[model samples]
Target: MKKTTFAFYRKTMLTMISLGLLLNCSALTFAEENSNTDENQQVQEEILVEQTEVLTEEVAVELQKEETVEQSNKSIQTPKVHFSIYFVAEANGEVTGQTKFDSLVSSDLFSNIVTAIPTPVANEGYEFSGWYWGNSYIGSTSSEVYSYFKRGAALSDLTITAKFKQVETPKVHFSIYFVAETNGELTGQTKFDSLVSSDLFSNIVTAIPTPVANEGYEFSGWYWGNSYIGSTSSEVYSYFKRGAALSDLTITAKFKQATPKFNVTVKFVTEGKGSLTGNVTFDSTTSDLFKDVVATMPTPVAEEGNTFDGWYLNGSLIGTTSQEVYTTLENTKLLESTEIVAKFVENTQAQDPITPPTDTPTTPPTAENPQPEQPVINEPVEPVVNNPGQAQQITPVAPEVQDETILDDATPEVINANNLDTIEEEVTPLALGHDSWSLINLVLTLGIAALAIMMVIGKKTTNDETRKVNKNAKVIGCITAVISIIIFILTQDMSNPMALVDKWTIVMLILGLVQVVTSFINYKVKENNEVESVNC
Candidate 1:
């Protein structure tokens, strides 16, 4: 019997050990499953982050490419053109330094060309003398040469020379004429160059073209290159082909005797468009351009309330308005509009005063006069006579009374009563002040809670330890929430009823929300743990 019992005991011990081993294996399995799930989630998050980065890089590259294309397109369009004029002087049958042409043609020429011409003096020459009258024809002593050719005269070769003398005061006496044509026909008989006396004179005719009929042509101050040929001098010339429509013309004139003063004028005549005119002065030292020579509409006037808005030339604002008007001293061929706009400002009124109630004033009283006091009187009162006959033959006498005295003690009592009333009045307002203090306390409480949460999260030792750490963190969060509520209640003042109620209501609501969230999270964590245990 003893042997049998020993064997049964040993078998039971083995069964117990096996059950323990099975439970250990089950726990290990659950842990491995949780770790696998965590690793899979981390991989998914990394993939999402990488995709976002790649998309961002692609957008940046596309934007860079678009900018490069825009820059390339801007590099391909055409540039503006510029022109100049110079005058060559002849003294004693030889050419002196070149000078800028300064003679006034039509106001149109001055307005268009004179203003647009750059520096009148050439960098390589001495001071520039203006255009002289004597050099009106080829081979003349003093002549004006234009650097730019008219559209129709692109193939023409023109030569001009002028003569000057200092005898009996400075003068610009000279003569000018053009070689008739390629056929050797001279337009005017004038001995300009010594080479014209020989057979080479015919060569001059071949090199220059004769004036053709109906090809609009005009000479400066002369019918056909004819001018005052004596001692005094005039500068500049106007030459045009017959019937040729003049569009953009730049004329520079120079004088040999006197410096000329001139003004520019622009006139417009359109088939249906109304006429418009503008004028400005010319500076001998600068170049000018005539952009928008004619305006499509009449000049606008500034309204009563508005100042000059901007300037417009042809119907468009060329630039903003300033005290100084805009001027173009160079490149005068292009024409556009200058625009003007009117500026107006709005008016404003002053603020009104606010009045407070007389009974409960916000301002304190000044310390000038002392407050008035209530008065008290000391007097002896006679007994009532109505009951005098009740006592039989009672002697008529004043009731025995102590010396009448005005006691100052009652005055102190009355003052104390007033002081108590003032204290009661201040207490209510002070309570409202306490409500404000409660709000500050609430903020500090939230800060402490956030700090505690961070500390708990930081103390977690391992991935598996997060559950225990989170459980304790929830308790701590609850405590913090309760503390915040207590602080709000204690600091709340009912004297200003709305003050304490409004402030603490908001804080209580927030703390309640926190409590709800913590409770839900704790419940979820517990449920999740239970599910894992059951599955194992």
Candidate 2:
């Protein structure tokens, strides 16, 4: 029983195995068919896409052809323009002829355009002036005219012409004259004749000829027909007008005789110091002209222990002043010559340099033979010794009388006239009333006062320079004032106090003038400074 059952089970197992193999084969075949169908759809889609691309390319080519046709239609609508330049020829107020060749210019051409300028043809007795465009002138030659035309732009057609005219010139001539004289007499004459052109002018002579003068004569003035022209300087015609000078003219020169002069000699005879006279000039009596000549007089300088003496001319005292002297050329006295001498001597009023004698006489003076009182001489004196017996025997001597009156208290002292004359040799004469020392003292005082006043004025003003000047003025004024006061005291007695100011009147006047001038200058400067500041 067991063997039969096992056989049936085996048969069932085989049948199940066969069914499984069939199911697997069917599934694989269905999968293969689906893949082939997907491949066929993909090939159809690729073919449709290629056809759509070809149709778009054809549409673009047709649009390009239409655009090309529209461009060709616009190109035929516009046209280019061209222009030509012309030139003509003309004569004086007439149409002469035409030129063989003319300028050919075009508006189409740029800066590269070049046109030929027509050359002027030959004409009888006619000069070619220049080319002309209406009222505008070009040049005389074709080359010069073409240069002007080339520099311009060609806007339109135009024409130009060449002008001609005749030429002429003029001739001219001139002449000049000169004259000279010596000592109011004619000496010589000069004539200049020359040719000139309307356009040309020249100097007649480079210089004037010098005139000859006779002995004791001099050239005076130049004259033209009795009218004074000028000096003997050269005249010129560097600037001359055509046909202006045609006829010859005469000029005259004048002269005069030289003047006479005199010699003035100076001599210093005194101990002081002095200047007398020197070289001087005077005009001649022959000439009407007067020359102002200043002759310098000697400066009187005082020596130690001495004073200045007045000047003497021909042994006679003339004056004591040492100022500048003036004389005319016609003075006959000066022609004979002049000589002046200055004298100086010791000052007796000054303190004595030597000691005096102290002894007194024992005998009383009688009225008939009065003796001079013993003098207190400053100079050295010899001593006398009286022997008792010799004094009784000696004879009485008479006293000498002096020209001047004796003082009431002292007995009159007698001196020789000749000796007194020697002492008075240097004394100043009061002929002029003013004493030199007194005058000088008074002047100095006045000057000092005036200077001080000026200083004050300057100080009151504005400006640094003015102030400095004022300081100097003040110092000088003070010094002068002190000196003047000392001089005034020494010159006069104390009894005449008012005389000090009165004597210095001239000096004061001069000083006042100086102060006024200085003040004026200071005021002007201050005003100028203020004006400058305002301008700034």
Candidate 3:
């Protein structure tokens, strides 16, 4: 800009000097060439000579600029570029401070250097935003302004624009919190990493985070309130949509301590016709790190004609009780395979089992009176006994049962294999060694008692008769007591040999003992009477 102004002033001053010299020379020439009158010559010379006072109204600055550019183009080889900055219709700022530079100049070498582009001013109620080329904001002034003009070929006319907006207002950012219980945590959350992105304020949406629980614990679920939501997995998508309002609220991820459940099984150890009580199995167990149980156990049930003996734990019988209300094995024990069973024993108090009559002859037949052969039972096989080929029925004795209670009358035995050739005789279904009473044994005991009663009734007592009667009674009582004791021992369960406190066996035993005592008393009385007779 300075160079252009200096050039203009210098050319104007030189033009005035050249005109002054020409005027002085032209006045002298006009006086020497024509020796006419001073007045006439003066008029002619006045027209020829130039005046010293110069007019100031010169060529237009725009015209001078054009002429200077044209002259420079012809002299210089550098290409020209037209650079400009202006405001668009929507711009709310002043357009005055557009950039200024020399109108006509060479390249950067000879041109006035431009420091920076002036920023546009904004109207009241508005603020200057930024300078934009088209759609991009390039700030108040272009950084490339230094080189913006020098590099472009073809007089670059860049029409830069500016934008403005209402005065500033405070802005708010978004954040969220996903907190877990003591033993749990969010899937990807770390102390350094944020729950939401870069503090986003709008259009905020994110995937629902999964919760993780430590060992021995389970992730109950995510909850907004204190109440449980009853879910263990995260939602398939985002919990909130893009347009939903978001805040810095917290959603709790709840967890629970894990517990294990065990399978419980209750078993019935009886088969004698009866209904059983108590569950066969239980799938309930404690929920803790340690093992302990406080549960009500199942009761024992016995069917009709049978009594509930007791409850059993594993394989051992709990005391001789009706039922067990709770578990016997607990606290670290019976944590795995546990078994509870209900034990039952049949009632044997009913007297006199009905007997099936056999077709045996009234008396043992001798060789003189040969009896016809008895019919075979269950088959047509002939008897193989050595004496008259007489076959005797022999039933097998049952073995002592264990673990499970066996039914006494399960099946009647045909005969012992060792005595297969013996004649098939009628046998009772109830065998010895079982807890039930044998029908044959019951009948034999009753017969002994009846025989003793008949012998004592309606008999006049002499000394010999009295002595014989007392002696016979003593022998009978001993036999009765021995037989009753053997039968009772045979019918006992070997598993619990000493548990034979049943009423039937005790009553029978006492009856035999009473008869023995009575015989002793009778003998004492007879001795006393004999002594009195001797004294008289």
What would the per-residue lDDT of candidate 3 be over residues 185-262, giving only the tens digit for each residue? 787642222233344312332445678888878887777567554363334123432233345546678889865445
Worst 10 residues of 3 by lDDT: 395-404
* Candidate 2 structure quality by residue, lDDT tens digits, 373-411: 335332223432323333232224432233222332243
TM-score of each: 0.21, 0.20, 0.26
Error of 1 at 183 (Å): 87
- At residue 270, candidate 1 shows an lDDT of 26
Off by over 4 Å in 1: 1-156, 159-410, 416-431, 434-467, 494-501, 504-510
Candidate with maximal TM-score:
3
Q: Over 4 Å off in model 2, which ranges?
A: 1-81, 92-111, 142-147, 150-152, 169-536
Q: Report lDDT per candidate.
A: 0.39, 0.51, 0.51
RMSD of 1: 59.4
For residue 157, what is the lDDT in candidate 2? 55
- Candidates sorted by lDDT, best first: 3, 2, 1
lDDT tens digits by residue: candidate 1, 439-527: 44445566656654544454332236547846665676758665775655565553432432445556555665665566556555666
Error of 3 at 56 (Å): 38
